[model samples]
Target chain A: DTAVSQTPKYLVTQMGNDKSIKCEQNLGHDTMYWYKQDSKKFLKIMFSYNNKELIINETVPNRFSPKSPDKAHLNLHINSLELGDSAVYFCASSQDWGQQGTQYFGPGTRLLVL
Target chain B: QQQVKQSPQSLIVQKGGISIINCAYENTAFDYFPWYQQFPGKGPALLIAIRPDVSEKKEGRFTISFNKSAKQFSLHIMDSQPGDSATYFCAASGRTGANNLFFGTGTRLTVIP
Candidate 1:
């Protein structure tokens, strides 16, 4: 079974168009995260939730909002997407928020804004 | 500012040769260090990891060499095979509520047969 899964493997939209990406993890993990990988392949964390509570919010703009309905699901919604929003979004999950916990990543959703 | 710096944005190695990727960090608070391997069209996967206390950790042909004093660590692939070619990332994180990972730019390794 896939430990972490993401829907809409690819997305292409125009500027000002809003879109959402869904992520789910079946590893029975309590912590889930959203990450953005830019064109240069630099990966950075956007948001993190533990047990349906927001734990980490980076310097991302307000256009990007992450919602976790439960411990297994975390979704990302982008409002009025801009050209700079083009990148790959990855969903990850870990047993918990700890220094030693191993995070498992999903395949990733490739987003392109025109 | 990038907390972790990785060198040689890209590398090419012949089969049966050794592939090495180096990384440096500026945060002394970082206690967990990990190397992630990512293939094309896929997300990064944890390949191996090391802590400040350990000087080295070896798993199969992949080994991580860590130096806490120098605040530097490296990944060495022994007898690298074509299948091992991928983009490798070095990341550091400290114990926090989020435990956010600070990732390096990434080193793309190409193993040629």
Candidate 2:
């Protein structure tokens, strides 16, 4: 069984379009995260949710919002996407986001905004 | 500024050789360090990790060396096999409160058999 799973492995949308990416983890973890990997392969944290509550919100644009319906699911919604929004978004989950356990990652959602 | 700096952005090693990737972090608050391996069209998977309290940790063929005072760490893959080829990342996190990781750029290592 895949520990972490994401839907829409590839997405191509135009500017001003709004889209959402779904993520689910079966490890029963309390924390889930959203990371954006840019063209330079730099993975930057976007948002994190612990027990369905917002925990960490990085310096990301306000248009990008992360929502966690429950401990097992976290989804990212991008509004009015721009050209720079093209990148790979990864979903991850960990037991505590600490040293005790590792963060399991999903396949990834490649988004392209034209 | 890159909080965690990684070196030798790319590396090529012969099979049965050692492959090493280095990383340094600026934040002293970081207490946990982890390395991840990623293949094409895939998200990264945790390979190994270390805490500031320990100087070294070895798991299977992958190892992590951490220097607390120097704020440096490195990943070592012993007897690197061609199957081990992948992109590696070094990351750091704080000691308290939802320690979200700050990742390094990445290191692409290719093992030639």
Candidate 3:
């Protein structure tokens, strides 16, 4: 079974378009995170939710918003996407919010904004 | 600012050779360090990790050497095989309960048989 799964493996949209990526984890983890990997292969954390509570919010623009309905699901929504929004978005989950725990990541959702 | 710095953006090695990737961090608060391996079209997966208290850790052919005083760490693969060709990433995390992790750019390792 896929421990962590994401919807829309690929997303291609025009500028100013809005879209959402959904993530789900079956590992029964309490902490879920959203990361953005740029073309340079630099991974940066965007947001993190622990048990449906917002915990870490990076310097990402307000256009991106993350919603977690429960501990098992976390979704990212981007408003008025721009060219800079094009990148791979990854969802990860860990048993706890502690650094000692290892995070399990999903395949990833590639987004392209023309 | 790039908190973690990694060297040798790409590397090529022959079969049965050793592959080493180095990384250094500026944050002394970082207590946990981990190395992740990623294949094309896939997310990064944790291959090995080390804490500040440990100097070295080994799992199978993969090993992690950490230097607490220098605030640096390295990943060494023994007898590298073609199957091990992939992009490797080094990451560090500070504060015990925070889930935020600062990641290095990446290192693409190619093992030619």
List model 1 lDDT by residue over A1-114, tens digit each: 989999999999999998999999999988888999999999998887776367555479999888888778999999999999999999998887664568899999999999
- Error of model 1, residue B48, in angstroms: 0.4
Candidate 2's DockQ: 0.69
How do the candidates rank by TM-score, highest first?
1, 3, 2
Give the CA lDDT, 0 to 100, for residue B12 in model 3.
99
User: A1-114 in candidate 3: lDDT tens per residue?
Assistant: 999999999999999999999999999888899999999989999887886357655579999998888789999999999999999999999888764568999999999999
Computed on C-alpha atoms, the DockQ of candidate 3 is 0.76
Q: Compose the digit string of candidate 2's lDDT tens values, residues A10-57.
A: 999999999999999999888898999999999998887786357655
Model 1's CAPRI class is medium
Q: Across all candidates, what is each one's fraction of true contacts kept?
A: 0.77, 0.72, 0.81
DockQ of every predicted complex: 0.77, 0.69, 0.76
Q: Compare the candidates by DockQ and give the number of the best one.
A: 1
lDDT for each candidate structure: 0.91, 0.90, 0.92
Ranking by DockQ: 1, 3, 2
The C-alpha stretches of model 2 lying farther than 4 A from their native spots are A97-100
Comparing 1 and 3 by lDDT, which wins? Answer: 3
TM-score of 3: 0.97
